[model samples]
Target: MDKIIIDTAQFQRTISRISHQIIEKHASFDDVVLVGIKRRGAEIAEMLQKRIFELANINLPLMALDITFYRDDLNQANADPIYAGVDNPIPIENKKVILIDDVLFTGRTIRAALDALLDRGRASKIELVIFIDRGHRELPIRADYVGKNIPTSRSETIQVRTEHYDGINQVALLQ
Candidate 1:
């Protein structure tokens, strides 16, 4: 079941729409912080931040969160932990946090991120924003804002690529 549903232009448009919706729902970017999970999630978060800044002229804080060590699947005997460097050390306590991720397949990653965040400090509220929501969630997690909801089989994979890294923006379905 190989399919290329979302093209570059469509992907960009979807992202733009999501950004606008985020700004609208929040009323403003004030006190909002965009925190992206490592790898592609970080890139998506940065792109969203750029759009928000351009649209509202409000520069929201962008933070990177690396949960490599926090993942429940990784074991010390099988893999060595790698930290994807996060730039900000500002405490998230009492701040509105928006967790960004490229794809939401299993809910485990979000759980790990929440754990890591709690270790640092408490957030006033945490809302999830995902570019692609491929359903097969192991936990009860759901996205507050979703770019697209793609029904998928367990064997399928949803890939999200951004212009910042891949020189193009698109979402591809691979088996």
Candidate 2:
């Protein structure tokens, strides 16, 4: 069964709130860049980027990251070796990087993203931002900015769909 957790309006408001919080914390967007994990994360990053642009009138650098090989559980047997749509080599040195993603669960994906990000460039500070944070972290990683925190069991799954990718704007909890 799938149950809706967030509607379109709520999702937009969440993104807006997150944008305002980021601006409030950073105070300036001059040295901040948004780097999103590939797929859904990229969509959310773009949304946040546009929101920030509308609010602060600053066009922050945005980059999409693919961490295929960085994943630890992937098998090399039948998997494709090629990683498509990789990063464009954005300079993150001495900059604040806000990593965006759809959901934060086990923290493995974030770990892989961190490794992939480090391979590109070193940032002065790296913070995580997630639309949904479900609480079953295997690592110590935590989101600096969270849209919603839903305590979920290990068996449940959280899905965040955006119009940019999933053809809808909603968040759902699935069992």
lDDT of 2 at 14: 98
lDDT value, residue 16 of candidate 2 = 98
Q: How much does each candidate deviate from the true structure in C-alpha RMSD? A: 1.7, 1.6
Q: What are the per-residue Cα lDDT tens digits for candidate 2 across 35-120?
A: 98988998899999999999988788999999888988778448666686566658888889999999999999999999988887
Q: Residue-wise lDDT of candidate 1 within 71-175, one digit each (tens)?
A: 898884466677866767557998899999999999999999899889878999999999999998899999999999999889888988777777778888999
lDDT score, candidate 2, position 59: 87
Clashing pairs in 2: none
**Local distance difference test values of all predictions, in order:** 0.86, 0.91
* Predicted model with the maximum TM-score: 2
Clashing pairs in 1: none
- Number of backbone collisions per candidate, in order? 0, 0
